[model samples]
Target: MVFYGVSNFITLFLLFLLPLHSALPPTTTVQINSNSILVALLDSHYTELAELVEKALLLQKLEEAVGNHNITIFAPRNQALERDLDPEFKRFLLEPRNLRSLQTLLMSHILPSRIASHHWPPTHLHHHTLSNHRLHLTTNPTGAKTVDSAEILKPDDVIRPDGVIHGIQRLIIPRSVQEDFNRRRNLRDISAILPEGAPEVDPRTNRLKKPAPVPAGAPPVLPIYDALAPGPSLAPAPAPGPGGPRHHFNGERQVKDFIQTLLHYGGYNEMADILVNLTSLATEMGRLVSEGYVLTVLAPNDEAMAKLTTDQLSEPGAPEQIIYYHIIPEYQTEESMYNAVRRFGKISYDTLRLPHKVVAQESDGSVKFGHGDSSAYLFDPDIYTDGRISVQGIDGVLLPPEEENEDESSTPIRRVKTPLVKVASKPRRGKLLQLACSMVGSFGRVCS
Candidate 1:
């Protein structure tokens, strides 16, 4: 009898919980349709926003919300995210621990209900975001629509039966996100509990003792000439070590690019061939560039190069001597050269060839290089200029003063005309040729 009474009491207790269990609502999963607004948003031109939404992992939650009511999304332009967004803030949002903050920031741009441009109120009105943040919608006096601080660049940019998207000029940042970013970025405040003191001051200078930070875009303190390798006359300089010094520019690539540009720019093929094919000057130039040296090449056109005789190129190292006279150690463009010549009557530029300087002057409203019979005019202003390597095209080849004088005086007829200036019975070859031959002979190869 006691067991039957206890069993009846247990049955009555179970019967009491049945109504409570039946009163609760059933749970159902909402399936996203192929033609849904969510799909449209993902496939739309607003790819940046879609990527953020997916990264925030709000798709499932948003799908459930969409199943219940329509939503309005304010999308920023792609450039705003790619270029205008602060790198630090973007990094903060992408951090694993800041996932909630990212979701909140993205959700703040969305409204729970459809609010198209036409549906927007004429006066200022506040709407609740999916994140439960308030967004102020208003129209300016000029009749342009705005949400929060961003102006609507395109109204009703993407419209679906269930939702609408408006294109905005920039991102709409929330106060919470701003505060979170500030709280995270401002390290001084977080470490304020630790004792702090004033910066150390120097007794002699009466200024902060710490070394001054280098300013952006300041030129390097070291001069280009100091970086050049020293060697015997006409001998190849050894390559610079990797860890020797800090390089401010990629000199080797710049030199190669300038040479290639000369080849492609037309009318400079001869100059390019002599530097790259006929000699190892191209490699030497690359090394010079790699060591932080800048070079300005006064390239002669093919027509001018064709004027050279067999004797000019036949001697050992003659090609190098001719080319060296054309290469100025300083970086100069057409504009700088023209301006310098215009300011000063004439300017003499130092070349790689030792003790030789090329003179420039303004003539016929253009910069003219060299002088007298062998002078060349700056035909092409700037063929290539990349901070380190500059190439300018000229109409004629430039010969050194000594070479010009020797050519004029070496002639028998000229010597007969002026018998006072005694000319040598046997002509002497260039010192450069002798040095080149000696260097080449060391390697058991004939230079000529």
Candidate 2:
């Protein structure tokens, strides 16, 4: 016990006498003002990348971005590059096919806004990079670490400036995300054919003609918003302006305004900071509405929207159909609807000005607007908004019926056939004949 205590004390005394400079980073905080740091990085032992970027003029751009602009640089080390880069990517950058690849490679490291390692939110998130699209810093669900999915030969090349730059093991590009966007755009789906029109189908009977529909189950798909108000805030909502005022609106600005109004009316003005980051599909939305294209929007409530991801809303053409579904062709309200049991009959209606059918029904005591899955209860019958469209809330996601899988190559199901046999029995036959005769009420021919 005395020897062990002596060792610990000796270790502590040695640490106390050690030079502080060798024991820690110079400072936990740093300040940047001149070109000294960049020069020092160039002169540092990490010569391979520094040499390549020097030849490529990467340093020139870095100097420009960092000139008194406080940049954080993630500098990579020589051994780190050899240790971290993907073998295939390393080969591609060295190849001769791509010329503009170097610029892409360098720009991938820059971000428009300064983001220090400390400022990085400790949560899973998708962030836009300096290049406008590529380089999403995907933090895992645990949020303990982050990566760009591309090689960072050396991580955390600390620099005192606007932001940090790490020497990436290879160049970064936007091919994967770009390709995914294309694939989603091309994939086909079952769409409702309007009796009169839909881009995917003929205007005749409105039945599917080619590329037959799939079985989507028996649920009736209907529009979901009761009212188009932004959120349930008590703040005064934006009045639906006439077409002229709406036409000149900056799409992003309009959405922000709508969000603010919704928050105010919903009594959530305290969340104004969050409203500042709101997004809009307004320009596209306006185009669809102006062209008289039907739109229905499945807006996730604020609770739902907060958890929404890029996977949910990043598709380029998604806003079109989504907006179409939200719009009913003409205004519809419960008071204007025919609810009499005698008047219960199927009638075609318009959504975004396109023809659709509303199945009407009446029971022993109640009136049903639509049966089964297609049912929509008019929570607020005359809830009028903007005088352009009427609003009603619905409980579940409404969609067309699930159809049978009609792929031709599949085999038919087998069924067992019954055999036929006749037996002669005098006494039993007499009873069978009587039974048959009993089956015929009016005619006594069988008994005769």
Candidate 3:
């Protein structure tokens, strides 16, 4: 009897232990490679730096340098690119004719040898960059470090066997390049007064002939407003015009024109569709725009919207809620955003959706939104702004923090029902228990 009892106990133990072993997920192994550091940066939310490396085609060069020599990179956070750099300068670098300048600017951020924070000396030191430009580094008595004029905000952001990254507070522009850039920009500004293809002046009246009137059905022309112009402040919506539709204004046509422009020209077809078909938001947005109410839209690009699962979008009222989250009920032009960042370091504003707020942070020069692990940058800022309506392009969809928390906490509880079995004897009861245990073990293993 003692032997039988011991055997039963052992059998039960083996049954539980075997299932657990089989149910555990297999461990996954990731192979580190040349691009591993870059991947790490991306995983750590350093997307802006990753993009610059890819755009300048410096990844291979950085990788090769890592293999042969110690490499250090002065990476500018996304905010730097967005809000810090001069708009004209950024445009100039992107121009096809300025590829060499673009490469040079990118290379100037890299040092041939690794220089960790501890290695930095109190006195000014000279380091050679890949661009062949000599960068002057200095550490002050207060322990503030700078490369050229750019302050080192974060040191040893990433230190690995291959390379290291230091986050800078500003972009480094070499003196020679800066001088040339300024000269070119000045000439360009001067030339704007007399455009190359502009029509000859009518000296008789000192004014050109009026252009032909636009067709009745033609879209309204979108006026380009200066980004530096004062942004709109919160105010009561205007009452409807006499005998006009309740929500309609004389500016409604312009609002429609803008939406159409976004659809056909701005490459926001998916967003446009959501506005037009998914909800009555397009009409509502138009009304808001026409009423001169200030609004800023965190417009997600088509690719970002494409990442959503069918279920996420198909649920009732989900699409509208998501759209509401994207629209900030304030006029936030690029200049305003930059000023906000400079003044407060960060800004938080209520979205169209009640109680949900979007957080904005200015880093380096760019602006990033949301917070913690769930955040995205304004990949394309100042897409379209006219004091009353501002549309900025974002790279990802943002979920409200409360919604995310609720989702994490509310897991579905599943219950299994077993068929009732009538046992006639002790042997039958024992057999049923064994069968039930085996079925449960199998099911548990499968679920796990």
Number of the top TM-score candidate: 1
lDDT of 1: 0.78
- lDDT scores for all predictions? 0.78, 0.42, 0.68
Worst 10 residues of 2 by lDDT: 218-227
Ranking of all predicted structures according to TM-score, beginning with the best and ending with the worst: 1, 3, 2
- Candidate 1 — which pairs collide? none
* Local error of candidate 2 at residue 300 (angstroms): 21
TM-score of each: 0.41, 0.30, 0.36
Q: Give the Å error, residue 173, model 3.
A: 34
Put the candidates in lDDT order, highest first. 1, 3, 2
Candidate 1: tens digits of C-alpha lDDT, residues 1-448: 9999999999999999999889999889998888788999999999999999999999999998899999999999999898988787799999988999999999999999999988988999999999999998998889999887688999999899889999999887775775566546434332543322223335566444443344322332344343344423444433232212334344555566667567535568899899889987888777766544678999999999999999999988789889888989888998888899999989999987777899999999998888889999999877776666788899999998874565455446633464577766875768799889888788776544
Candidate 2 per-residue C-alpha lDDT over 1-448 given as tens digits, one digit per residue, 9 for 90 to 100: 9999999999998888787747776743233345455665666666766665665566656666566454544444565456555444455455445324544554555665566556665554555544455445544565444445443444455454445555544334354322222222222111332112212223465332443332221111122221122432222323332222222223333233333333322323222333233323444334333322223222223432344356635665333333333345454455445453446455444333123334444444333444585454333233222222233433232332344567644777676998978987566547877877777854666567
For candidate 1, the per-residue lDDT at 283 reads 80
Worst 10 contiguous positions by lDDT, candidate 3: 222-231
Q: Over all chains combined, what TM-score does candidate 2 have?
A: 0.30
Candidate 1 Cα RMSD after full superposition onto the native fold (Å): 22.8
Worst 10 residues of 1 by lDDT: 237-246
